[model samples]
Target: MTADKKSITALIIDDDQMVADMLGQILQDAGLNTIITFDGKSAIKLYLDKKPDIIFSDFLMPEINGVMVLKAIKALNAKIPIVLFTGYYNQLMDELKGEIVKPDRILRKPFIQVEKIHDLIREFFPGYEIDA
Candidate 1:
C-alpha cells in the first residue's frame, strides 16, 4: 500500500538523543510524522501505541537492542518496514542471519545519508516527494 506523505508516520528509536532527534528531523522534513524514543523498552510501547508506518531503530541499546525490538514489532505487525541502524553492521548482520524477524534495511551509523533516508521513504511510499 502506498502511503501519502501526510499520512505516513515514522517511529525513530535511538539511545542517543542527538541521533534520534536528527533522524526525526530528517523524517519530518520528508513529510512523515515521527515519534522518538530513547530505549528499546519504550520503543515497543510506542510502536504499539503509535502503529507508525515505518520504523528506524539503533542496533545497540540498553535492556533490549534493535534486533529484539524488531522481533517484538514483527510479532505484532510483520508488514511494517523496520530499518536497523548500527555502527557494528557486520556483527549485527551475522547475528540476525536466518532470523524469523529481519530488518528491511541495515544502515551503518556515521555513514547514513539523507538521500538514503529519502530513498527508503520513496521505496515504501511511491510518488511521495522529499522536501528540498
Candidate 2:
C-alpha cells in the first residue's frame, strides 16, 4: 500500500546540524517523514533511493553545492519538489535562476517563521491535512 499525501516524505540537505534538525522538527510536526543529509553527494544518493516528495537544501554546502544537487535531482526524473534554501537569497537567486529556478521554491534562510516551511508544503500539496 502507498502512503497518503499528507504523510509525504521530505529530504533536508545541509552541512549544518542545527539547520537539519530544525527542518526535521518542522517537517515532522507537519506530519511528513523527514530524511536528512549533510552534503550534495549524499543528498543525491538518498534522493534517488528514497524518492522523497520534496527536498530542501542549503545553497552553500561545501561539496557538490545546492545547484549541483539540484541538477542531479532533476536528472533523476523523480519529479519531486525541490527548494533551494540559502542565507543569501538575493545574492544567489538572481545568479542561479537561469541555471536552476526550476525548483518548486527558493527560500531565504533564518526562516523568520518556522511554520512557513510547513505552510509552503501545505500550499504546494494542498488537500492534505497536517497533523496537529
Candidate 3:
C-alpha cells in the first residue's frame, strides 16, 4: 500500500448529518479512513489532528463555511487535498482560490456517480486499491 493511500484519511464537513454520513460512507467504501464534521471550525480541528489526505466539505454551512475551513486547513497543512461539495458552483473556484485550500476536485451535491468519487481518491493516491 502506498503511504499516502494507507494514510488517506478524509474529513466530511457539512451541517447536514445525513450528507456528512452519506459522504463518509462513500469515502469509507473507497478505502479511506473517514472523519465527518458539522462545521468548519470543528473540521479545522479534525484536519489539524488527523492530517487527513483529503477533505470533502459543504460549500455553505450554518456556522463556519467550507471556505473558512479550507483556509484553516491550508494554513495548517498546505499539501492536504480538499474537495468542495457544492450545489452552488457560481464563482466557486475563483472565489475560493484565495480564501481556502483549493480543492483538487469538485463533487456536486448528491453525487450520482460513485465511480467518480473513486476516481478522485485514486487520483490522489494512485497505488490504492478499490474493492469491487
Candidate 4:
C-alpha cells in the first residue's frame, strides 16, 4: 500500500548543522516531516523513536558517521531507504565496495538539485508527488 505523503517522515543526520537543516527544509517543503540530528549516535536514538520512512545521512560525522548509521538502521529495518551524502563521493564509494551492507542511495554534496530530493521521495513512495 502507498503511504500517505503527509505521514511520511525523513530522518536527516549530519554533523554540519547548516547542511542538515538545509536538507530538512527541502524535505519539509515537499510535505514530509523531518527529524534532524547533528550526530550519528543521537541519530540512532531518533531513528528508533521516530521510525522514519527514509534517511539522509552525511558520510563523515564526528562520532558515529553515516556508514554506522546505515548499518544500524539497516539492521533495525532493512526495508527502509537510506541515502548517504558526501562531498567525497568517490572515496566513500571505494570504501563501500567491500561492505556487505550499504546505503540504498548516495547523494553528492551541496544538495544543489532540489528535484533530486523530491524525486527520491516519489520513487520510494509512489503516492508522494512534490512539484519541482
Candidate 5:
C-alpha cells in the first residue's frame, strides 16, 4: 500500500541540535512530519511510538550509537529506510564492514549540499513533493 503523502513522517536522531534542526527543516520542506531526538535511547522510543516512514540518525552518541539504533529499528521494521550521519565516514564504514545490520545510507558531516536531504526523501518517498 502506498503511504499517504500527508501522513509521512521522519525520525531524526542527532546529538547536535543545529544539525537536527537543519535536517528537520529539510524534511519538512519535503512535506514530511518530523520528530527530533538528541539521543539514541529516546530515538528508539520515538520509533516505536511514531513509526516514522523514514529515519536519519547520527552515528555517535552516549549510551547507544547509530549502529545500535539501526539494528533495533531494523529488527522491528526492516522495510523502513534508515540513513546514518557521521563526521568519521571512513572509520564508520570500516567498522560496519561485514556487519549484517547496516544503514541504508551514510552521509558525511558539514551538510553543505541541502539537495542530498531532498534526494533522500525523493528516493524513499517519491510521492512526496519537495519544495524548491
Candidate 6:
C-alpha cells in the first residue's frame, strides 16, 4: 500500500518516561498516532491490542528487553517494522548478532530531530509526505 493510503500508528516503548514522551511527541507532530509504554512487558500487551504499524523500543528495560519485545511482536506480526533504540548502540548490535528476531532499524538515544522520526516513517511507509 502507498504511504499516503497507509495508516501510520506508532508504538513507543522505553523504560524512561521522558524518552517515551519525547518520542511520542515527535510522532504526534509528524501526524502519526502513537501509544507509549514504559516497560517491555506492558508494551507486548499493548502491541497485541493496538497492532500499531511501527514500533520504537529501547534496547534495555527492566525485565524484558527490546529484543524480547521484538520477538513477541514478530510472533504476532512478522512484517511490522520495529526500531530498537539504545544509548549503547554498538553493544546492543553485538548482542543481537545470531538472534532470530532482529530490529528493522537502530536509533541512538537522545533523539534530537523530528525529521529523523519522519524519515523512519517515510522509509517504512513509502509515499509518506510530511505536511507543512
TM-score of 6: 0.93
TM-score of each model, paired residue for residue:
0.94, 0.88, 0.87, 0.95, 0.93, 0.93
Query: Candidate 6 lDDT, tens digit per residue, 1-132?
Result: 567423788999998999999898888877788899999999999988988999999999988999999999999899999999999988898989999888999989878967787888889988777662
lDDT of 3: 0.79
Model 4: lDDT of residue 74: 97
Candidate lDDT scores, in order, read 0.90, 0.82, 0.79, 0.90, 0.88, 0.88
Candidate 2: tens digits of C-alpha lDDT, residues 1-132: 444755599999999999889888988887889899999999988987898888999988896988888888887774778888899777676667567436778888887686678678777687767774
- How badly does each model clash, as a count of residue pairs? 0, 0, 0, 0, 0, 0
Off by over 4 Å in 6: 4-6
The alpha-carbon deviation from the true structure for residue 117 of candidate 5, after best TM-score superposition, in angstroms, is: 1.0
CA error at residue 124 for candidate 4, angstroms? 0.5
Better of 3 and 4 by lDDT: 4
Please list the residue runs of candidate 5 whose C-alpha ends up more than 4 Å from where it truly belongs after superposition: 1-3
Better of 4 and 6 by lDDT: 4
| Prediction 2 global C-alpha lDDT | 0.82
Off by over 4 Å in 1: none
RMSD of 4: 1.2
Q: Which regions of candidate 4 fall more than 4 Å away from where they truly are?
A: none
How well does model 6 score by local distance difference test?
A: 0.88
**Positional deviation of residue 67's Cα in model 5 after best superposition, in angstroms:** 0.7
* lDDT computed for candidate 1: 0.90
Residue 20 in candidate 2, Cα distance off native in Å:
0.7
| Clashing pairs for predicted structure model 3, backbone only | none
How do these models rank on TM-score, best leading? Answer: 4, 1, 5, 6, 2, 3
Q: Model 5, poorest ten-residue lDDT window?
A: 123-132
Q: Which candidate, 2 or 6, has the higher TM-score?
A: 6
Question: Which candidate ranks first by TM-score, i.e. highest?
Answer: 4
